[model samples]
Target: MLSKRSVAASVLCALLATGATACNGDKGGPAAASAPASARPSASPVPTLAVDTLTADQISEQAHAAMAALASVKVDGELTMDGSKLAVHLTSDKQGNCSGTVASPEVGQFELRHSGSKTWLRADETTWKKAVAKEPGATAQDAAIAAELFKGRFITGGDTRAELAEAAMMCNLIKGLFADDSDKGKEKIAKGSAGTTNGVKTFGLTVTTGDGENLTLHVATEGKPYLIRMEQTQGSEPAAFDFSEFDKPFTVQEPAADQVVDFSVFEKKVKKA
Candidate 1:
């Protein structure tokens, strides 16, 4: 019924009205309502630790008790170090024996006896006399080296006093015999499954030192914490002790009253070239 020009004008006006409505919606209408949902903040993904639930005093008490339990144990085991393998036995109570060959790549043979408080370092007769004359003290350093030499020549002079000190500290640390309780850190030694070696149920504890050394101490009984094995892997050297034999009826004797320990034997004097 309408002419072609009138029909084209009607369609153009309708399109312009629709575009204006769309523009207005974008500026401040339903489009703005949808924007807030996208811009809203997301939930956090980080996990939280429950450390706030524990106090420092509680941690210290736990650590001390654990160490005390460790110190009260006695153990005997085989010891291997520096390519030399030996039968190692130790008793925290009073007496034990370690008898083994020092091996090749080193010189000598050894049979060391420790009864009561006395330790006899019996070396290949040739080396024993040499050491008795060279080193003359009873300090831990001298005693450790002497113990090694008694078994053979696998030890060297460069083994520093610091190394001996560290060994002693490690031994005492496990025993909870710190000179100052404050020296102990807030690290707890954890207990693992019960293991049995030689028909004895052994309890295990693993401790990591401040310097990052990992050591495992195994005790054979709960009431009596006799050490059955010790494994250490901290530095370049891996050290361990395995208790293979136990003699319950063996007579335990004490060192003589007049016997003297010369710690000075561990001191090294520099000689002028």
Candidate 2:
């Protein structure tokens, strides 16, 4: 009976040791640790992009085509031209329809609603005062009166007047932005490192235009490789334009009858001032 008990105990000890060895082969199970080389999971492969291999100018041409195909987009930017810094926020289409605002130290701030041939502008008190004072022989009293009279009202007109024509042209803000002469000195274009803007991955192309302005154009890495943003960081007056809402449709409604004051009324008021 003693011999039988010893044999059974030995067998049990051997089984436990084998089980422990197999279970503790590594952090994972024995099969995983000792699996054939061909059976192991492979690392995920990185995706290849054709745009990444293209030349800087080729990439820019592609981006320009993408931008040109866009029917409408929301453009927001801080621009410096002729030593004046301006902030612009606009939702415009290729068809000359836009509703947005442009702000600057000289203009103060003004909102524009332009559709077809008509344009409506609503200027803040500072802008109203400035506009009134610009008229010939206008006094401070006139500026004050004009500012109060047109406060919170939009001045409407067709493209007949100079102010109206200029305001109406703002509907093509995107066109003016990416004009054909935008990058006249294309020979100086240099490819930049990959980065991201607003969570979208992009690669940049730095260029010095004919006007000597240094610009960095960031094009999206994925999808259609659209021009996502353009930044001017090299000059004394830094500026940036962020493009979004591609191909989105927007509408600009005419101001309410009571809220609108005709441009003739504004002109008469300024003349009296």
Per model, how many backbone clashes are there? 16, 0
Superposed Cα deviation of residue 73, candidate 1 (Å): 8.3
Per-prediction TM-score to the true structure, in the order listed = 0.37, 0.75
Q: Across residues 1-273, which tens digit of lDDT does each residue of candidate 2 receive?
A: 223233222221221222222222211110001111221111234232366579888887777777777787776766555465666677898887998876667547778788888877787787766654444444576557657767898876556755466556656755665544544444478899887765566788987666666778878776666677777776555767677777766888989889887756644554443
**Model 2 C-alpha lDDT versus the unseen true structure:** 0.61
List, residue by residue over 6-36, the lDDT tens digit for candidate 1. 3322221221222223222211111001111
Error of 2 at 258 (Å): 1.8
Segments of candidate 1 deviating more than 4 angstroms:
1-87, 90-105, 113-119, 125-183, 221-225, 233-235, 242-273
TM-score of model number 2: 0.75
